[model samples]
Target: MYARPAHFYARILEAPLHFARIPDKAAISHAGRLQREKKTKELKGESDSTSKAKPWVDQDLQDDTEIPSPNQGDDEEDDPGSELDLPHVPYAPPRYAVDSMLERSRDFYTLLNQRRSVRFISPEPVPREVIDNVIRTAGTAPSGAHTEPWTFVVVSDPDTKHAIRTIVEEEEEVNYRQRMGNKWVKDLAKIRTTWVKEYLDVAPYLLLIFKQTYGIGTGGKRKTHYYNEISVSISCGMLLAALQNVGLVTVTSTPLNCGPRLRVILQRPTNEKLLMLLPIGYPSDDATVPDLKRKPLDDIMVHI
Candidate 1:
């Protein structure tokens, strides 16, 4: 075999590192094909992973239903008030000394502590003005995006109240026997509650609270009511407090799977869903309460 020339060896040394390792056309084509296949697999894997992942939260809590936004159309102008910056007003509440604050807090707690859910409500008429004021206080609760998506339907007519009772009883009977599991029924046994809700007819007023899932805007387009359920829940807390303050009594009742029927009977719009049905009045002379204690603050609260 002939030995390679010194110049040839020098040329090889001078060549680029990549040029020295240049593959044949077939080898290069095969590598390119493999790379394309790998990328396809990666993209497919990514799609599958996304499709298989669970939702971040429960479907009921997510309120995933979409509403057609009023400003979505090209011809429609965006609502100017929604985007306008509002001027802030100064807020100054009266301040109290430390001892006074402590005493006030204790007194408020004591007053609220006396409050109880009384199933036996008196049929004596409650002043309409008082109910109005209590509901107005509830409306002061904070809401997401300031939507204030709550409605208080106060029913006083005897026939309408009875109709509500009929609907509630029909659904609650099924809930007790089948919908609510055996464990739930057994647990409620201690409270001596059943499907029978006589207070619905006996009470003087039935306040059916509804949450507006969406609102109508200009041109009849639907606008989103963000976190409507949560907003209404906060308002209900204030309403309950107000009721307690006025020496009135009520039992917060949520009729299971009766929203549609109650909504129809009450002649409410389709956008609204029933959240709570409270029969409000004075407690009966024979009204008795279950002996229950609330959890301690330490048990319920966490401080970081």
Candidate 2:
């Protein structure tokens, strides 16, 4: 019924001509889930000041998702009728040969492959400047409509870390004992994670990434931030990579039911929601990670 199905699949598996011509079942399912999540956030009035468009962008409509073109006419709302608006300058990024690009990618992958999320971390003091640099690197991540929607609360003081650890442990204990069902707990058994998060205070810094649901404009009025989740997620990825590049280790930790308490502790505004907590420092002397293999590329990629 099919013309050379086996040969077609073999060519797709071996060759590299077709980079992204087919969408697998997982891609479709993920897109659908993203669409639903975007809907839920909108219902909660967590909208951006820009276009009230769907949070999820279809592959074909990816360009449309961007609110403004880089060179689009003057958006300086203050002077609506000003004819002296300056146009955007030409972008002149350096071009690299394909071989050099591939080599750099491979080198990066090799470096990052050594990174592991370790629970045991050192209590040695990290310089405040290092923290500032890492968070600043995260801020450079791209965001929707250029509305960089992320706040990093760098907690270094011993007293504050202890307070955060207390609240986090309190909430986690309840989750492990009551909230987390058997299946969920069992699934976590392989990674050897528990409710006792002693590293929260052990690490030199606890960076909390908060997603700004909206912005405060002039006169304290509410303004929307676009694609908040996407923006914050990109920032977090950059945060981890920046930390790793500087020879620091970190574990991505999330505390449930502790957001309200944390907000009070950090004195954050109402529009910000805590998205992730990262404990950053040097790994303990006996730090170890599970010996695991990554999914093969052929399994994840497809061809036309």
Candidate 3:
């Protein structure tokens, strides 16, 4: 039997960058029944636990389901002028020899294979310029309609970091006690994670990534940022690779019920929504990671 940690179950509320555990069928069935019962009570006004709406949900929308488009209420005359009017330029990047290409690919794979999600981080200061260059590399990711809709907020101030930590911990505590069900709590017992996030303060830098849902165009018209989520996700992948290349360590976290408050505290405009939070620094001397294995190529790849 596994002992459930209330705080450990909070990850289910916000979601994670990666899901390393799969709950058993019996557990899933139990959780489904519980959710159904809760919904029934809520419908009958017999429970007030969720009397108010969750901050993350867009309450204005019906059923709190649709994410409002930026161009939804714009007048027909509010034309967002064409952004691709500029002339295209010809360019060619260097092409390597066949042998060199194979060697480089193998070396890159080896480097990335060693990358791990390290929670223990050192307080040693790192060069700011290195971080700048890594972000620059991430900015080169392809975007839909060339609308590069992403913002990276880097926080280093001790006070500000503490404030962010407080908010995350408070929300996490509430979610664990009131929101999470038993299935998720039991599933997370293997890795032993809790709501307490000391690394938010211990890491030298906190990188918060946001995705811009829309862009402001000429005459203050709103322009649709197509596939903004996918574009930002690609950039995040490049960012992780860049950090690994520079021998830095970080763990990706998506804190549930904490986005709106974090955005307000950071003073980001309403157009932006938080996507990921990463605490980055050198690994601590005694840092450890679970012994895990990647799936074989045969299991992951589908050959034609």
lDDT tens per residue, model 1, 6-78: 3333211121212212357646765676666667768777543333322122122344332344444443323
User: In model 1, which range of ten residues has the least summed lDDT?
Assistant: 11-20
| Per-residue lDDT over 68-158 for candidate 3, one digit per residue giving the tens place of the 0 to 100 score | 6565564322322244434435568999999999999999999999999999999999999999999999999987556678999999999
Q: What lDDT score is found at residue 63 in candidate 1?
A: 43
Top candidate on lDDT is 3
What are the per-model C-alpha RMSD values against the true structure? 19.7, 15.1, 15.6
Off by over 4 Å in 2: 1-86, 179-193
Model 1 local distance difference test score: 0.75
lDDT of each: 0.75, 0.70, 0.76
Query: Largest TM-score belongs to which candidate?
Result: 3
Score residue 211 of candidate 2 by CA lDDT. Answer: 80
Clash list (residue pairs), candidate 2: 49-224
TM value for model 2: 0.69
